[model samples]
Target: MIFLDGIPISKWGLQIQQEHDHPAVPELRRKAMIIPGMDGEWDFGSESGPKPFNFPLGFIEYDKNEKQRRINEFVAFLLDPYGRPREMKLSFDYEQDKYYRVKIANGFTPRRIHGFAFFDLPLIASKPRKNFMVPSDEIVMESDIPILSDLLWDTGFSDRKITSPQSFEIINNGTVVILFSFQMEGSGDNVSFSANGKTMTFKNFANKSLEITDNYVVKVNGISDLTISNGIFLELLPGTNQITVSGSNLNLTISESLTYQYV
Candidate 1:
């Protein structure tokens, strides 16, 4: 069975196969070659950007009388305009709690079968070529994270603060770079953050709302600061990562959200 964006589309019972009669679903794969020749080709390259997922051909056999309904539903739910595919969360390996984010790459056509009908739809990995870990959307919500100062909090709760580590674990199972978004409002002489084994520091900052992401420029109080040295947008690796934030006379609250993916 296959689920599209958490909805099972194979109520009619579909069979994923290698070929017309191979009776096996071809393995879904992602392929890429080196990076940092900085020039081009033939060197130590990393996993290229998110690649497309080419699903092995699959057959969806439906009752002859219900052919029209099945075709309409599949097309309506999966395809957008101009043959462009829509991103869908497909669930095939339910036991592992993983879903592939994909869209139709080429197109699908139904061929008449023995008194029935069938079609083939291969998918393109929408963003990343990794299978997203489920519940699908997992979040880490931390409240009461101890801080050196409790400047921002409930009224009259400023004096009840401690100087404990602002640490959390990022549970990313994918072998790819996971973009992380970090935003916080605070002030200090020097603000420092340590993730995994990398650290970033900001000096002479006060009363500012700082936002940082792996894909864009760092913004301080609504102003983009491209010259901020030691401003490293940290990417999370596979497994549990140790993250800590510290600074002299710094009191702040940090909110972070990272989407998990796996190959």
Candidate 2:
């Protein structure tokens, strides 16, 4: 099965035959140039470049009456409104929980032969990495402030969940470092999330939701809250990463999704 932007192409009556030059590793971008008299060229550094993907597909529908409508809808689904190329998530059933960020490359042209339609979809993966899915983890942290209790009245305030700062290990099986996002809910005067020795702290957090997006932007209740934030974004290394969530004078629940990548 083939999926583009989480939509199955087979749903449009198209069948994926074979893909040409689907790269396991992306193209290399090198910053080295040849020195005329040097025995070996001067080498600076190399990094992964954009990858191309070509999918040869065929339509299974034979009815000429419905072909035009279905083809139009299928084309519309693949292309953007203003013809601007945007990145779409592509995945296959064989590689579970993994996807590629790709955009339409070149143009889509379909040919008809014997009541069958065939086309080749060209895609470019700009990010040039496979994103692996990770499950979200949640932990509730206790506030440093103490609650008052009366012996005679015996309020149920003591039954509320009160947890302490939590420390956990996150394992990244990929070959490179991965940046992730996290969310915090409840109330607090200050909260901090730390991973791999880096910590990000938020101040004046009370009865609101806070999040660090995948792009390293901090948000509180869906608005940018960078003014009250400090420190670097947390990241996971290739192996195990130690993570800690702590808060002061507040009840907080932290949740995070740990997505890793492969070249």
> What local distance difference test score does each model get?
0.56, 0.71
**Which residue runs of candidate 2 sit more than 4 Å off their true CA positions?**
34-37, 60-65, 81-87, 133-166, 173-175, 186-192, 245-251
Q: Total backbone clashes of model 2? A: 1
Model 2: lowest-lDDT 10 consecutive positions: 149-158
By lDDT, the best candidate is 2
Task: Assess candidate 1 and give its lDDT.
Answer: 0.56
lDDT of 1 at 20: 28
Error of 1 at 92 (Å): 1.5
Per-prediction TM-score, please?
A: 0.61, 0.75
TM-score of 1: 0.61
| Per-residue C-alpha lDDT of model 1 across residues 1-263, encoded as one tens digit per residue | 55668665555455555432211233434454557755555544344344444343334444665666767766777777765577787665432355667777777677777655656666655455445443212321243322332122211111222144455555555556675556767666666777766787776676777777646568888888856537566766766566666667766656554445555
RMSD of 1: 9.3
Q: Which ten residues in a row have the lowest lDDT in candidate 1?
A: 149-158
